[model samples]
Target: MPSPFRHTTPPEPASAAGPVRAVYTQLARDFGITRAPTFVVLSSVPEIMASAWALMRESLIAGDGGRTGKELAALGVSEANRCPFCVDAHKMLLHATGDHALAERVARGEQPADEDQARVLAWGRATRIPGAPELTPYPFPAAHAPAYIGTALAFHFINRVVSALLTERLLPGNVQRFRAVRSLGGRSLSRTVRRHPAPGAGLTLLDGAGLALLDHAGPGPDWARATTVGPAYAALRAAAGEGERLLDADDRILVRETLGAWDGAHPPLAWDGLPGRDRPGARLALLAALAPYRITEEDVAAWRTPDRTDAALVRLVAYGAFAAVDRIESALPVRTAKEAS
Candidate 1:
């Protein structure tokens, strides 16, 4: 007998043209299905994202060098979030970017080959297991430290935003969208936020970046907050870009002091005498306190561990904390005349 999954008649196109119609058209074209695509109708958010994809593309490019870093970051975050859709999407993106080996490893939940890839993968794993705060550090040779730290920090922010987007179900073409295109580096979570309606309508709440979004539901609040962390993130990025030359005796002191504070606040959630809702805030405060020392990639590189699992998780948290600090620092105004100009 013929297979039960044999080709079936296609669905009729919608009489009225809309976002769904457009998606249907695109899906049909992509999948080579003459019939309409089976995806559920999406809201205006996806359409908005499609229209403003360029801006989002620019944001990701500006944040990282290109799709490779962005994809690595996305994969790390997806792994952290435990979102199957995101994992699939990021894996596809990685493959498309000629990172076939890394893509295969990520699919198997195995560690990446290089420190940068490994660090990102670790970040993703850590995001899943929140109880093990000690798992945030990376395990790599000292020479690879700065790159690992910078990449880890970048991936942390990427993971936060992507997780929020996935949580909100704002991804284009629904959950399977990432499978078709692979690379989300061309997209921005900011655009996703601007395009979609806030989950709770007008409820304002704190996000990872310490900013508030009007619609504070799902991942919206988190991404909204992350947007506000731009300044601190930029500062860290600047320092990382400058490489080892940026470090000094004062920088070392700052790093040590900040690391000490982080050690004290390592498991901010585990601290006794804290309210339930206040845990995340407390963690954020602890992270903010470490901002001063996280000025360079070298500072971040110093946070690695030897054990694979523990190293991965620790690196993830460290990355998030570092990104938060970078965004905060970047927002500050430059007092010097040259900077102001």
Candidate 2:
């Protein structure tokens, strides 16, 4: 099937070269799929690709909570974000974990029959809102905290990327829904998903600030730390670049101002009151920041021109995702050691 991405194309599973090559190879060897559509779009920037893949692998796939719990968390986030791509992917992953009945119920928008599964799903949905609940007496056990939070955050970043860059179509048509097709899809990931490095494994590459961010919220679980660093650094790095390629001087100021004054709520943009509403990149940035789930093709159509390359869109989206992630992270109730224990 032809790709829905207009800016970037998926690299050949065998054909990817450079920094992404090693990561792609590891994904193929470990997970069965060589190039995930999400990672493929992220490959527009090799650094983003490598960093995102490592963080996601450590937190979601390989972290403390079981795959079933993590997929539930991911599903909650994607559902809140209204991202069909990730919703379908996680449903497939749940089935891959050998819970076809539960997967079907979730795919059909039913709650899981299990109580613990229901709690996890509830927490994930709550996490999408700014300051919705406290982490104290978290629904799951302390050990599972990192895995759950990390999974939510990772998809918080990923759902945005998918919504902005990729199309919603999982397969050419409804073929993605066929039992045989999704099951075969599940088989491919069954092997590699369980092979991730132990959660909280130290990252050798992080600098002082990066390390501090991981450590800032106290001696949290390893998976949580890994999850925080991945999105935080990736967002900061994207900000360091020439995002101006999309938003001009005034548009940049508008984005920063809007985000700075944000109250951690997804408010509707009074398009008439917003700055840079006329510029597609700026409009996309605001939608990503305030109401990412609300972003539509019209938003993209407004900003994209012959000159706006896929690379630019990727960076712009990354910036908005990080902006929102940063806000959510700051408002997240910091867990104390006593509370964590």
Candidate 3:
């Protein structure tokens, strides 16, 4: 099965040097996968990769809520984002958590039998809707909120990346559909996906240089604050690129201005209303922001007659995802502000 990764190929773990090699080894060992595809693709920018892994580890992978609840939240986010790839992946993980019936219910688009589980899923979906005020009265206790929030935020970024960069099927062929195969795959990963204490701040990768980015998110679950940084870094790094940007100066200005006025909700902008240039690249950026899942080969055809390069397309997608994330994060009331004072 040939990989669908075209814009940027996952780097060989053995060939990776220094920090990149360490990140690959740690993620592989801890994640219980031969290769963590998302990490590998993000490794195109090493700093982004390391910080993303750390935030995910601190929040979702190593947190308090059981695997069932966490995976449920992940599935909800994936479903809302319309990313079939992540939806399938989380369903497999949910099955691995020994809730076969529950997993099937979610995959079937039905509510879980467990009320708490159902609430978690509902919250996840709610977060995907931008500018959704009154996100208050969380379904879980204060202590458990971080894990769920972290998991949702992590997958929010992930779903966008996977939709843009990778193929839908978890495996190359139809193997992902076989219950036995998904179950076995989940069991294999069970050992490696243990929880860890939330590592609060002071990560060397983020140092003083990038610390300010965390402020935009305005505090909450420890995991949310940290996870917000990953997308921020991605957006900034892509913006800083010296190459020919897909969104030129005027297009960039339009996106920023339009996004500034956005109501912070999904299905917000109409297709034609989205800011775009006459060129294919700018039009693609508008499509990415308004309806990423709708992007198809025809949309890609508009930009590149031959084939899409990894750098610009990936960066543009990241920027669009972050723009949405930032809008939501900014709209929500600050959880950590009162505590800080």
Candidate 4:
């Protein structure tokens, strides 16, 4: 099969070494898929790839929460981000949870008949709105907040990278649109979806990478403290922050100020304050942060000189995506210890 990757050489499982190989091995074992386009697109940068996998593994696959609820949250977040690939993947995972009827409802864009589940899905979608009331009094239990919120956040980053870097086709010919294919894909992953590996397993994959960033993550959000989520989130934050180096000091400030004030609404094409193609780096970074789906071939060609490797391009996009991550992180509800507990 042709690689889904466009801008870089895909990592080889057979020859991958150290952390890269370890992540691939664990992803296969824990995620139950041989070719995850989502993770492999990131394999060009080992730390970023591992950090992303760790965040997803610890929070969504291994963290505390019902798989059904987490999967719904993931699906909702994907929808909010306009990531068709992740949306399909999560809907299929919902099928793997043996709730095919509800998966069908979500695939059809219908609200779940169960009101609580509907609210859960709504809460997930509302996440992109930043500071929206739907985020507070979280639809799920407080104790499960880390898993639910972490899962939402993990996808918030993943969806951006996926949307910007890869095509929307989850499968060749985009056959995932067919119900039978989605169910089959879901069935293949059922066992893994059914099993929640112990938390902190993904932390090992970070090894050298996450330790330095531990202090940077601070105590984590009030909702996710005392859990494995903090380290993974920090590790990813640091990894993606490397991309900031791609932009100049002035451009960096511009991107940050723009994203910081964003109200979580998607902007229209040709909106003001966006850098022109003349400043391809700033333009690409902002688009990746705000509306990655709008990135066009010319936008990339303008930035990709023969001297620039795929790794550099990936980091640039990660910088933009992480800016959005930072913006959303600030607006997230902050509860005190007593309230969190």
- Choose the strongest candidate by lDDT: 4
Per-residue lDDT tens digits of candidate 4, residues 1-341? 76676556766667777777778888889999855888888888888888889889988998887999999999988999999989989988998998999998999989999998999998889889888988877788788888887898899999999999888888999898899998988888899889878898778877664334455545455567778887888888898999988888988889988987899999987589888888889998998888988888898888888777888888898888888887887788857322766
lDDT of 3 by residue, 259-321 (tens): 677663455545556533346665555455546765666666666644456545666666666
Task: Name the 10 consecutive residues with the lowest summed lDDT in model 1.
Answer: 200-209
Ten contiguous residues minimizing lDDT sum, candidate 2: 204-213
Full candidate order by TM-score, most accurate first: 4, 2, 3, 1
Cα lDDT over the full model 2: 0.66
What is the number of residue pairs that collide in model 1? 19
Q: When superposed on Cα atoms, how far off is each prediction in RMSD?
A: 17.5, 4.7, 4.7, 1.9
Q: In model 4, where do residues sit more than 4 Å from their true spots?
A: 208-219, 336-338
Estimate the TM-score of every prediction: 0.33, 0.80, 0.78, 0.95
TM-score of model 3 (CA atoms): 0.78
Q: In order, what lDDT does every prediction score?
A: 0.35, 0.66, 0.62, 0.85
Error of 2 at 83 (Å): 0.3
